[model samples]
Target: MGEQQIPDATDPASVEPEPQRGLSRRGLMGLALGAGAAGVALGAGGGVVGGIALGRDQAQAATDAVAPASGIHQPGITTPVQDHLHFAAYDMMARTTRDDLAELLADWTYAATRMMQGLDVSATGAVGGSPEAPPDDTGEALGLPASNLTITFGFGPSLFDSRFGLEGQRPAGLERLPAFLGDDLDPLRSDGDLCIQACADDPQVAVHAIRNLSRIAFGRATIRWSQLGFGRTSKTTSDQATPRNLFGYKDGTANILADDTAALDENVWVSASEGPAWLAGGSYLVARRIAMLIETWDRTRLAEQDRVVGRDKAKGAPLSGGDEFTAPDFAAVGSSGKPAIDARSHVRLAHPDNNGGIRILRRGYNFVDGTTDLGRLNAGLFFLSFQKSPDSFITLQRALSTDAMGEYLRHVGSGLWAVPPAPAAGASVGAGLLGA
Candidate 1:
């Protein structure tokens, strides 16, 4: 009945985790690395910037005070395996009516908070190695989530309407950027309706969160549109700590380190966007989605599939040897004389130049569900990338999209939003863009 507290990473008594759902080594690796933690940091910054409130409740009273319009109920009637759940939802915007803005935002904030509270605490903000409980160490030691929910909000040209004197709307046919053009994109809810880009560890939770947020925006906010996300199968921690994707192959063998914030800023942020007065301190565009296509992916053989991904299925090590993100010797050749890491593999597709010239911050989740008619649901990823130009993500994805592995992946749901610079103290959310 009291305010529910996140389990301490070190306090076993506080961790009331569900049963192990076959934690994949890759999944556990991804979560432990704080892959989804960015969203929490995004929303919770302003007492809960993006959509998460942590530290102490008194300090985050504004964030903790709000509850979602409806609770997120898990799908399985019986004890569900933790790894089976996944979700990735992000969005872009279009013009909205000015009169409807306030109401829409209130609903959105309320819905997001409630939905977050609805998730299994472990999945939401609490970081854990297994589904059943939190790891023995928490807090500054690991930066585990206070909940599984990870939501990020951003503004785009469409969020503002020219009719109201707002000047950010995109022209027709080009309103949304190339990266965000897709079938599953969310519609405008209102002129002032804040754009939401969210991802969860579970799909049912993600869907429920989206739907409930929609109810609030449409019913009270009078916002005109909304978007939902679908993610691809990713590596996740199962009960056994084995790594596997929807296609059953290990994923995320190649990733930047979590502590590498400086590297993230250098490699991912767009310096050009910061030059403009209105855009100063603003981060570049971030468009993301969940892609689900494990069934089609499952048809390939392990050996052939490994070649396409360029990593060992069991260990998540690069074909060249060490685990993902570890440096690979491009000059090294295999027994047949071909590069140990295929010159054309996904790794190579991303780093074709060989100086490690290209990089994008990838934060994705893994999802699976029995209720889905689609075969063996396993998908989850925030699918976020920041750059000076939309071309950064576009260029990299273009390189990989036509490759052998690209054939196995599809973009099911998508979003386009801007992540401005960190807010100054006392600055309101979206202040950098909205002018408070």
Candidate 2:
């Protein structure tokens, strides 16, 4: 396969064109297994965000990365970018290997840095937006390969030492990891050790970068993990969709929308616990994670499952309407007097207040990697969402956790961060949130 293209967000016609096919398989395989290439200095490869020049120096420092001396072999199975992709996995550090996880993470950053160097780069959204624009395609708009990219990184508690081992005190640097901001590519956050995510218009390039980095990290790290991605259909397109997670449900229904006043305001916050004034333009507090329970979930009856979730299991439509978010007629109950949607269904339980309402913008993807003890695993969504407060998301999840929906679901991994808002002109990524 050449490259599976990412679908466009706005006018589908505006997406990238496509990549040329057939890079000899034998050559690609050899490159995949070849030794690491000489290191190349990594920096902003000349890109702009919101009309501002994100300098090469700043970009390089943001990721603390340098390009790979050489590239890897191209794979035939180029991943596709769907509406969303999600993934979930047990943390290896939490289970057994705690001390060596850092080395693994270091390698992850290194490999990822290399992979990104090969992508079609551009910046699509303003750090905080829903129905986010795919990678910037200014290059394509100008009749060149789309070059915009958006990469965000998140570190879960499991990545830290305290959560990794049974010992009383956490290993050094693990605690500090939470405060280290890898690449301040996102507008909302600028704290945390280093969690680097790079996006590009070409799905093949993006997938290769991610998988290569992840595989490199796996080679050195001691954590059990999973990943979800949206690869481009071809080298030319930038349109991308989020993937679904193991639960089979589009997981990010509760994320904050971008470019919306309500969303921007909701994402803004003040907390002394978060450091520095330079972090003002940022929104540093987002809890991102993946939950997997499909095996258990798949066993439930479709009708019963629909009732429990308050939506058509297959169509994802609300009890009374056309689609997932469509208005639901709560009064439409069955002759048996049972609510058309169970009173405690995930949806019903989540949006208990018809007036106050619950809203979350979900950005997730689907994934299928290696086989597990259970069987061959199919995973996806890189479950991510932004909320004004944990209370909103928590209240809803708490309800689901205790209800029938919780039976088949399991919280496999979690990552919490203080995401700062994007900065204004001539400012660093989190200038506003950091009070810079």
Candidate 3:
């Protein structure tokens, strides 16, 4: 019943891991690297695009608490939102066939499974693999524990095109998101054919997951865009407190809890009755990179800010009055002969009471991307939401079209993806859809 632990990087007990079924690789395993191999790796720089040493030593995952990776659902979706995230979008290579895609998923699932269990992608990790070739893992985390890592994968709308012969299997509800009110979308950062969301308590672990995965995808797929985020803006468990967004407002205060199976089934999981059998138990993932205009909002009066969010900034309580957890009394009126909570307030607009009882599971984070060229702080919220159908998110977003808070926000990037269920043991992700 005690917590499971992984072998240390230098442990002699470690041995080579078998390749997942149908996963054939070029390099040999279990051959120790020599001084010359070390020398070669030292000369290599971190950039894979350049001809440098990537320091990719496929070693055991040095981690602390381990997060279970194999389950009915993908790990990061309902798992307690981690403290850091490394999210990347990828596009399948040109002229690639269905087999290529399936192989890629198989490889990814194998590596992800190992990493989540606090092991390297392969058994002969880091220095244990043939030293002549590049290491299977990027060795930055050799001594680090898994740090409760979770890797979640998603298939974007583009992947369902004729190229994969998945057109007929596309769900009726899966499509590109409609244009929102204040969208200033960046084409380069917008959509992709696939995406991977890596989250962990330790930032390096999250980054390491994506780095290794991207390396695995060298010939088959390329990264479209990626984002690093910290300071979770939402929680999936009741034990976690409501985290704040860049705006300093407590975000996702009424979010669905991890233990609320009833709500999760209703709002997050796609049921068999929903159709498109391949994605029956999965959910739709919607990501929006929302750039917050803090300078403008900072200049606004405090009282006006409360009116905009319909909640007291300090207590995170409804302006109509109660504690942080108190449901907003949207019907209450202020002495000014108007509703206490502004008509366009975010709380009222996004509340399930106002949105036809529709709710989405949020897993967002605050981001500060250094500074803009103009010297202003480049900061915002990386909003992530999971729902049974895309329509739920679209409806909520549409209701916020004229939100008073809209004046201080701009959505720069967006993507909608179908998050498939976790693969069964020894099977790769999307095996159901790929017929693997």
lDDT of each: 0.41, 0.36, 0.76
Cα-lDDT of candidate 1: 0.41
Off by over 4 Å in 3: 1-23, 26-64
- Clash total of candidate 3: 15
Query: RMSD to native for every prediction?
Result: 13.7, 14.2, 7.9
Tens digit per residue, CA lDDT, model 3, 99-129: 7787677667666656665666565667676
Q: If scored against the real structure, what TM-score would every candidate get?
A: 0.58, 0.52, 0.87
Number of the top-ranking candidate, with lDDT as the measure: 3
Model 1, position 275, has a per-residue lDDT of 39
Encode model 1's per-residue lDDT on 91-167: one tens digit a residue: 21234344334323322433343244442222233444456754311223122232245444455554545644556
Ordered by TM-score, highest first, the candidates read 3, 1, 2
TM for candidate 1 is 0.58
Q: After superposition, how far is residue 366 of candidate 1 from its true place, in Å?
A: 3.3
**Candidate 2 local lDDT, 1-436, one digit each (tens):** 1112222222223222222121122212212343221111112223222212233432333321222111010111011222222222223322334323433332332223323333222222112223433221212222222233333433333333444442332122223222221111232222232243444444543444444333333322222333445531111112233223455444333333343446434433323233334222333223333334566667877777777667775666776667755656777776677677677677666663642565544444444556567784544234444443444455455455446666554344444443333222222222232133
